[model samples]
Target: MIITEPKPFEDILEMLADVDEVSIIGCGRCAAASLTGGEKQVLQMADKLRAHGKTIVAEIVSDPAICYLPRSKEVIERLPKNGAVLVLACGAGAQSILEVNPELLIFPGTNSRFLGMTAQVGEYHEKCTLCGDCLLHLTGGICPLTRCPKNVLNGPCGDCVDGKCGISSSPFIKEEIDCVWALIYDRLKKIGKTEILSQTLPSRNWAAKTYKPQSIELSEEEIKQRGR
Candidate 1:
């Protein structure tokens, strides 16, 4: 799941300052799960805007999600072209809306946190970086790229002490985190798969981390075959 947090209301107000009329879009998936862009949140935001003297031209909580281009297009078509749009979803959903109509004025209502795994209701943990590479099998399912403070692939850095990672310069990982390589070693040892750690992995393909837009066109026969 993608984790998101609502942008500060003051910041939102600043973004919408120039606009007198606005349309709001919510997500029924991740944003809903995070309580950042659900129906309730959308309604609440609309009320806040109205109280602030802005006219609400449209409000919608998109089913599935606005990240789905088809749904974004559908929602965008229903909205008035005269008003600016405030998307209460992840950056992907907001971008999808822009893809549907580049001319539409779009504003993000939530700041994306990370791609995460849900621990429980209202709880999430970062698990993947979507690095476009897979080394989990060799590392016993722990992702060093995501979990390790330094993103060390081979093993813990020299600064590591005990089972904890070294302090990182990154603001996000400033606190000493548990060393993912140590966790991988312990997990592999417990399962009698320690030999897997002996082989050194090649340098990661950093280029793979960049996002590249994709398009696939299938013939009618190809599309029909996929259904089977």
Candidate 2:
């Protein structure tokens, strides 16, 4: 599941500083799971806005599932004149709503955190960077880029103490091992091959390897040949 968090209250206030009649739109899906911008949170936000001298024209309404099956049209039709929508969904949902109604002004209420599974009741940890490459096989399934405090690719530095990252004072360690490379070394020892650490990692190709938007298409002839 994708984890998300509500934007800071100050940021939200600044974003909606110009709006008078604002509609707080919530998603009954992912946002609700993270306790962000759900019906309850939206109502509370509306009350806060009213206290700040802004006129909230209507109560917050949450669709069953706004990210995938948005009821944006219904919400827009019910909005008061000159009302702007404060969307409490992921970035994709906000963009989708804008595409459906280009004239409607939309503001985001939550910051999309990461594509991660809930580690505990309220804790979420990122497990992947989607770097278009997979190296877990050599690293004992631990991603240093996402799990390590410094995002160290070469392993834990000399500063690591008792498996805790020395960079951040926070003792809230994600993995039991000191670092990904250490974990990999232990795994290799168990497999009777402790010499893996001597092998150096290839330098990453920055241009050919990036986490940016990309697209691919197949020609008509190729599609026909593939019997698609």
Candidate 3:
């Protein structure tokens, strides 16, 4: 899931200083799981915005699955009156809102964390890298790309200490999370897939996942042709 964390209320207020009226949109999926963009979070933001002297025209929680254009378009169009939209979701959700409504001013109220699992309440662990190409079938379903501090395609490096990865920080590493390779090995060994680890994986095909803002659309004619 695309985890996200809230931005400071004062920061949000400063962003909206020029806009007197605003709408608050929250996400119910990843941000909800992270406790950053759920209905409760949206209302809290609304309260905070009111306290800061901004007028709230409307408040609505976008479905956690707000990435869908049709659904998001409907919700966005119904947002009573919009001067500026304070979106409490991951960066993707904010973009989706913009795609649905091109005229409104959109402001993000949260920072997108890594793609990961919710290990426990109020705690999340980064898992998948959403690398476009998935290799979980061979890697015992654990993603090393995002979990490993070094993002090694091969086995653990000599620097790995006590099976824990030296991973930390965002956009750059400074702390340590778990060593995903160790987890992958244990999982593979348990399921009799250790042999898969013996094969040295090739260098990542950056061209596959490194393309910026990738998308493909099927025209109605293409859909009809494929249906045959």
* CA lDDT of every candidate: 0.86, 0.70, 0.82
Each prediction's TM-score against the native? 0.87, 0.70, 0.87
* RMSD in order of candidates: 2.6, 4.7, 3.1
Model 3 TM: 0.87
lDDT-superior candidate, 1 or 3: 1
- Candidate 3 local Cα displacement, residue 71, angstroms: 2.0
Instruction: Using TM-score, rank the candidates from best to worst.
Output: 3, 1, 2
Q: Residue 138 error for model 1, in Å?
A: 1.1
In angstroms, the error of model 3 at 217 is: 1.6
Q: For residues 27-51, could you state the per-residue lDDT of candidate 2 as single tens digits?
A: 7667777777578888888888888
Which lDDT tens digits does candidate 3 get at residues 81-166? 43688988899889888777777799999999798889987988777877777888878988878777677889798766777765
| Candidate order by decreasing lDDT | 1, 3, 2
